[model samples]
Target: MKKLLFFYFLLIGFYTYGQVGIGTAMPDPSAQLDVTVAAGDKGVLLPRVALINTTDQTTITNGNVESLLVYNTATQNNVTPGYYYWYNGSWRRLTALGDHPETITTLVNNTDGSYTYTSEDGTMTTFTVGGMMVDNGDGTYTFTNPDGTNVTIQGVSQALTILSYDNNTGMISYIDENSTLTQLDMSLAIDSWETLTDLKLNPDNIHLDYTDEDGVTNQIDLTTLVQNLETLTTIVANADGTFTYTDENGNATQIDISNLETLTSLALNADGKTLEYTDESGTVTTVDLSSVITNFETITTLVDNGDGTYTYTNESGNTTVIDVNNTETLTELVLSTDNSTLTYTDENGNDTIINLKTVVQANQKTTTLADGVNTTVSSTVSGDNTAWQVNVATAKGANNTQNSTLGVVKEADSNPTVNIANDGSLSVNLENTNDIKEVSGNYTVLPNDTILLGNASTADVSIVMPNPVGKKGKTITIKKQDTNEDYYINVYGNINGLSQLYTALPYSGWQLTSDGTQWKITNKF
Candidate 1:
């Protein structure tokens, strides 16, 4: 029996190691393939496949492979529940299909149903299910293990479409319900610059509290904004970070600058009027704007004349000169007393004279008398040797009347008295009446028509003698007989103190007459 068994083992080794046709004998397991094997030939030894895994093993046969490849063979679905493949001299076993779940991590979900797959070796591949493909935008996708470790799948340009990304990494992906496509968290969007809003930044923004070019203020709180402007159109932050805004009509405006010390230039157009600026020192100055302005409709120019007066001239050539604070209009003119003449010059340049005289006469005038005219007065004498003179001192004089008792001639005791009337009539009165006395001698009245008086008061004595008297002996005598003795007197005087003689008796009262109207006299002694 032993000899028979040795021979049996040898024959089985030969059949196993050598190649056999479809009709060749079956070989034992430990033998090399007796089949004709070429270099780079890949075929299965049927006994080696069955010997390594007695229940389940993969085998390769020559007639079933093309050239040197081993084609398909049935899997050991019911045998040892393991994986095996025939190669070299043995069959190798693999873990069963359910040994562990496939370690698949979903990195990106494209719009297509295709998924990108990766193995434990870090080898990457794409698998499709239900004829779907992913469009990964920018030709890339991410593959991840189940634990979220990621490997990038690039060159997906034509294969997959990207839908969203991780909020933090910005990794892109295809859309899937299971995939988290996070943008910036909506809560963190406040810090994100891409999504800013007017509602979010208006009253809360410090930059909005600002001013504009026009010196108007703008956007603060809504209450402050309304206080600044009724409404606004737009707001802009300058490069200096100062804020300014526009109105509804898009006009840039500013608020009044309360503290304007920093202003370098101010632009104001107050044409046709004076521009006044008041500084902090309470000094006011008027800006010279004549060259910059065209019309000064309400402006008034006042020029000062050093004498506390001013002159104003309008566009029309009318000028008004005013005393500084006096309200009187200049009308009346007074020429000083030193001025000799007052000349009035009219518009035609003609002068009219108005001269002042020394003194003015109203009615009376003074004049001198005409030459050769005579003035007369009636003069009378009342003493002895009375005479009348023509043109004596002060035009006329009268001497005393005749008195023969003493026979002494003297001037009139009183000044000659004359009475004259405006009608050229004259009258005379003797100023020395006591100088007349009784004549007791023969005192001849010259021219010889005389009578010596007896008592003419009791006797009517009238003497009418000759018209022509004797030249050598003109004589007269008188005798007194009432006494007891004879008394004789004679008074006669020559014409030239030698021939004429006259006498008169003593009488208490006497009278002489020559036609009572011409010459008549009476003496009482």
Candidate 2:
């Protein structure tokens, strides 16, 4: 009776192909222990193991239980309390989400005409250019290159491997080490026989090459004839994150760059926040140079604070008030080997002295001597010419002045008229030509002489002007005092050896100005 009950409890009656079903007599042929649940019934129940925290998960690793499911009692970082399944290397959250899509299938022709191939990860690829092989109905395939080169492969069981390459032009495809995806419309050759890091364009030339372990480069050849490129095409920038290019036939094509992640691709945008540049592939690439490039200097304008400071904008647009304390101007500075004593030459060639030693020595003092238009001060500001005067006087002394002078005076009327020798003298008494007016007919004028031609002479009188030896830019004025006198006065001491003759009209005047070597009549009536 126990044996009969055991048989009934286990199978109920039907058993086929060593399979059993709980709710249904007929079991799935593919499953050994198939259980069919009725509607509204709970699904399969997995073993429950609660983890208080993530650290406890380490203990479960001892068992070679891959794909084992477990529930978390607490949250871990951003992960919430949920069921996680052991995956290839880590725990993956399992939710009642959509299932993975079936692998997209593809057909590829190999060197062998009669062959089939599947990628490492069963994925679909449609290559339109570079080189393509056609599968002949008779187990043979023909591969044609852009330059009209062809190759035949025997029927094989594997898929044809493909890679990307870059031509000098923008039509190219390849991924860089940085996970950058590139596409190319140019001719390229790919093979599964060798692992290729990249088929990139050389920076110095248009050739693409492969670098070996020994750092040697092998030229990668491609078909030079590109029938797709019948015309010249170039890419341009648009408001949207896409590249605009006109095909050789002049058809406009827009390439989506919205998925691109960096500012290195400025055709994408270049507003300080973004930038774009052509990479080694002859393709424009962009990286988020924002962290790399910035308006840190662009949005900034300098403002000179009325104080000795200035203000400029930092990247934040906030004003940064800073004194120019971190800069030095080397106009004509000469420093000692120890950088202790420094010398500065001003515009006027006067030097300023800085004795670093004097900073600590009471007797030694820092001295600076500069000459301003009307003043000269050292290490201090002054409106008076004291500092300049001292330098000038010291330099202009008996042996200091530009030109040395011996006490040789050019006497005028008498009274030591003009003392050429400024020996120990601080003042020069100038001859007063304002009060003296002499009546003269014709005579050569002296240095300090003032003459008035009042008498009318019958003969043509020649009046010689004074020699302008030491005089520069000095003017001489002569007036006919008598109104009734009309005399013909001839003048000399000019470049032409004859001055502009003055017709003595009453109260008329003749003025002669000297240009050091020659005298010219400036005013004549």
Candidate 3:
């Protein structure tokens, strides 16, 4: 009995060439392993595990496993409780109907009746309605989707069928498919025709067709029109200041231009002897003035005959005499006693006096000094000579030393002490006082102000500091005199790397010094 049982098991294992079947004798030919349920409700159970994240594979203890299927039981790191399969080094959730809800982040309506849908995963999809809804005139309306699919709406009122269109009258003829034809005035829907200012035609032979007001159609040949324009009469300007126009029939008309006879320009000819002029018509006219005088002579000498008459001889040895008794000759000149007038005596012994002040006043006169720093101008008179003397003198305090001490000298110390070192450095010991300024309102500090006393008894006071640029090592002291109100010291630039300082205590003072770029608080009292 044992040998019979063993023989039956061996035969079943070898049946159908390695295909396995459970609960059934014959399995599907395509499936390597088939499990068939004979009776009660049952299904194949898959392995379930908790997945930490989509890219994690250690939860299943199979790090390099591919195509591994499992059921995720955790909801973390974008992973939900669902069936997932290992693919490309990550677990991808299997998509099924009603498995996961797809979230839409945005939905936008486009201008052309289209809708844009954006998913949570930054995926964009556009859906366009192909065209407007069209009436089919058969009690039905049709709409086209983006994919060229049509959707029909039934039970609508029937529309008319268009038969023909008249472009000239802008009328549409239609029929109801069961009634007489009717006309629709579509003039309001038609766009108005615009008049063209410039028209270009290709091949230069295109014709224009139009309908006249009398409803008569006409055609114009553009080629012929252009040829006729070329044959029209043309006017030509002649060289002799005349214009000639010829008609198509070969008849010519001439017109003489009178204004063209006027001279335009005058110049010497290239021959350097003859003068020539050009008229408006470009005609050159020459005038011969070279022969007008054969030989020219100039006066050579003049002699006074001592009888109030003179004789002159020309280069040709021709002499001429002239009476000089009528001509006045200046002999003696003298100035008036007031030095404001001058008198002149001619050869006839007659004296004529003229005011010199009037002549001097009519002309512009300017006096300039040599050097304003070391020169002095003064008027001096000696005997009958009067002149302006400009004296040059040494500048005050100019010495040979390169470095000099410049400061106010005190009464007690008539001469300030000056110390000079071998390295060309000089120092002065002088007495000076700080320039104190008192203010009760907002004030801008000046470059010369040294100490400021601000009084803020009734109201707040702000003292604006001067700019520290180019004033290196300059120091200023500001003190608040009264403590009744707020007092602010505002720096034109940064003070100790800050904009301003505030003080309200009585007699509170701040000493600020510039380090070239900005001001720094040196002392606070």
Candidate 4:
């Protein structure tokens, strides 16, 4: 009996390790469990087990048992109790019939009521939008489209016809063969890119926020940008001065043939000077270039003639005389002793008399002439002729009057007064007045005017440079009449561009010159 049991155990070993085949005595040595299912409605059965998800697959059995095959009975994986193979680290469903198909990742989008799918299998098989793929087996791939057309990429593009995208669980839903929606976990794939998290898309705004390489969260509006780019067209400049544009929708826009002719017509006339244009009514309009040629040259220099005259030199160095004087040169003048009436003698010895009255009442010496030009006479004693020093000016010096100030002249070895003629020019005809000035007051530094700060109350004062745009090249100088060298003065407004706003200590003086914009501080003493 013991010998019989040993033989039986040897037979059992042969059955377990042998190449066995059903309904065939001569089994193929290559297949261990090869089953020749004869001509009958019969099939080989596999081990049945409860369904589980990706996380629970490994927990179904322990210790990393590979190449395990089973039939899932739960149908949760959209497979009807079909065979499932465990290869690498996941549970992959297998069909009950033909050979196992490839596992792939897919991307789908809707376009014009139809759907376009892009998928890729691990075997270097790729598909584009509405594109297919075919394996050449010779290290090449052919991608095709639905109309039996191909352009390099070709393969069998499979899809599960997803139903909806779930925002809560971040999964995509697809209808299985049983008319049931099966949820699938979705992921984003970029070529050779590391895994990225914390990226979100806002469906309402159609924009996405993602952390960039610099670790900054930046948002980009992809929807509107794409829409704008789609409508954008590329414009090409033609050799004939025309342009053409082609948009993304395969539409060509052109500056028509007639427009090209119009463009050529818009050129300068045969003289290469005048601009010619043809209106829609076909009327040719030509502008004259004669005046333009003449005006191209500008006056470069305006030299002031000592006798209230100016010589304007053009670009060609040609000078033209500008006579603003209404009277002759005053070589000599007579000042009445009473300081009320004045007289003048011209160079031609012609006496053009003007009645004027001069009074030295307060710090300001007012000199009213019959020409309605009231000259405020102020003085700032400099080096020589302190008693005869005077500065005279009017607020608005119009040429509509005669030289009423001609008789108020106080000629000296060197006249210190700035004589403003009726022609809006300064001279030294020596209109002298009292050099006294009242202090502790504000004054607007007028063109060609001088402000005196001296001898009355406090020495501190203010001087302002008004906007003298139209009166360019005008000057205003401030001087201290009082011998106090420590008086304080606030000079406001950017004068002569020296200092827009500045304060001066006692005995400070400044001269501002206007250049039609702001005043520039010409001289500061």
lDDT of 1 by residue, 1-525 (tens): 999999999998876556544323543344443443346556654332222243323344332222222222444444343445444544445565776686433333344754443334444444333322233576766554323345565564334333543433324345444453422221121122122123223544543545443446566565665444232234333454243434343345332322222211111234633434333333444444342222212113445565644454443444555442322211211222444333433334455554422111112133333323343334456873334443312323334534322322233354534445566465554432212323343333434323343223333232223322332233322222222123433322222223322233443222323332232223323
Winning candidate number (TM-score) = 3
Better of 2 and 4 by TM-score: 2
Task: Predict model 3's lDDT versus the native.
Answer: 0.61
**What TM-score fits each model?**
0.17, 0.20, 0.21, 0.19
lDDT for each residue of candidate 2 in 1-525, tens digit (9 for 90 to 100): 999999886784455547878788788888988888878566876655655443345647476267777775556564456777776656677766444554432334433432232334543333444236587767777766545567675665534343433223323344544455534333123222223244567775646788764567887444343322222334444665454544333445555635423221123243534334443234543434233112111322445454545454443455645443333332344555554565655435678886634432323224456674434454434672233333222222255675754332334455654344446443345555423444456677767654445444554456677777666777777776654554655565763356455655666667777778877667776
lDDT of predicted model 1: 0.36
Model 3 residue runs over 4 Å out of place are 1-381, 384-388, 391-433, 485-492
- Per-residue lDDT of 60-95 in model 4, one digit per residue for the tens? 666435777777787554444656777787667774
Q: After superposition, how far is residue 310 of candidate 2 from its true place, in Å?
A: 54
CA lDDT, every model vs. true structure? 0.36, 0.51, 0.61, 0.51
- Model 3 Cα displacement at 473 (Å)? 2.9
Q: What TM-score does candidate 3 reach?
A: 0.21
